[model samples]
Target: MATLKVLGAGPVKRGITQIAAEFAKASGHQVNVEFTGAPTVRERVFAGEVVDVAVVPAATMDEFAAAGCIAPATRAKLGHARMGLAMRKGAVAPDLSSTEAFRRAVEKADAVVANLANSGNYVAKLVGDLGFAADKVQRQPDAVKVMEQVASSPQQLLGAGQLPEIRELIDKGVAVELAGPLPDALQSVTAYDAAVAAASANAAAAAEFTAWLATPAARTAMAATGID
Candidate 1:
């Protein structure tokens, strides 16, 4: 067994990292996981930084693989992400029982931070479907950054651009409850996947890590990280 490394966008990183830890400990492998933006991973890989694996939105990897930077056959779909809403700690959860309340909360907030990645894109489309003006939304590239924004302000409201991040904020007392169900008009149900870098010298170890991540034991550990 060899050390397994992973680099990906923020939302799934936490839960997946936890799951990876358990898999490594039980499988007798060392694990080093790095969380980053979608574009950054490709940049680093092209720059020759060594990495065993990369996990990113399924859609984003097609171009890289097609260009021969990533091993296409080594890719495996992980799962999907759902969007939700949040507020800072101690702020009462908003009543998102209806579209009216949800929209009103967004409009009334001091600032509303949305993601620009998978979760954020879904949220942006959601805002449009809900009939909110473009000026009403503030877009950020990462969900963790959004969480940081809302959590830093007790009065600020935050929207979960993705399921994993929304669950994480609530669990960590960063925000209040998530908003209503992420409708398709605004939801992308982001497809996540693990792919080996073409330059990876540790393909066998990387493949093993991905396999363990898909196992029941991995799911069990993920549950503790607000993965559902």
Candidate 2:
């Protein structure tokens, strides 16, 4: 078996990294996993980086395969993530139970922190739909960064992103508490998938590891990291 270089995006970061570690331990194979923005991951793969396996949005897995960046037959479904809201611990968790309530909370917040990638893009679109000025939304590099900003900032804020990312913050005691999932009507689910890179020197190992992501132990690992 050869060393596996795994490229992953924001939403799948925590879970996939842990699962990869478990795979490495069991298989005695070294797996180097890098977590970054979805766009960045796509760019890297397109740029011909050493990506043996890619864990990204399902749609991206398809696009990459179509573009000949990854092996066409190597795709495997991972899990889904839902956008949600978070607030610093002890702050009033705003009412996001309904669309109207959620809208008002976003409007009233001193700052609404959101990621600049998937969840962030979704939020930016929502902000436009609500007719709010773009300046009202503060975009961070990723969900964890949003939590970091909200935890350290003095202003009252509401952070919105994938529930798993928010949970990652709470798990690390980042002074943030989940408000809850977005209003059911507005909730957006992003499913993730993994595939072996077409250029991988160790395609066999990569394919085997990609398949392992669907195993029971992998699900447990994903669940442990707040990914379902």
Worst 10 residues of 2 by lDDT: 219-228
Worst 10 residues of 1 by lDDT: 179-188
Candidate 2 residue lDDT tens string, 1-228: 679999899667887888888888888788999888888888888888877998889888878978888887878888788899888788988888899998899888887888878778888889779888888899988777899888888898888889888887688789988888999999899989899998999999998898889898888878776677
What are the clashing pairs of model 1?
85-179, 115-120, 119-161
Write the residue-wise lDDT of candidate 1 on 6-106 in tens digits.
77765678767777777787878788889877767767766777788888877777766777767777786666665667666667666655667767767
CA lDDT scores, all candidates in order: 0.70, 0.85
Candidate 1 Cα RMSD (Å): 2.9
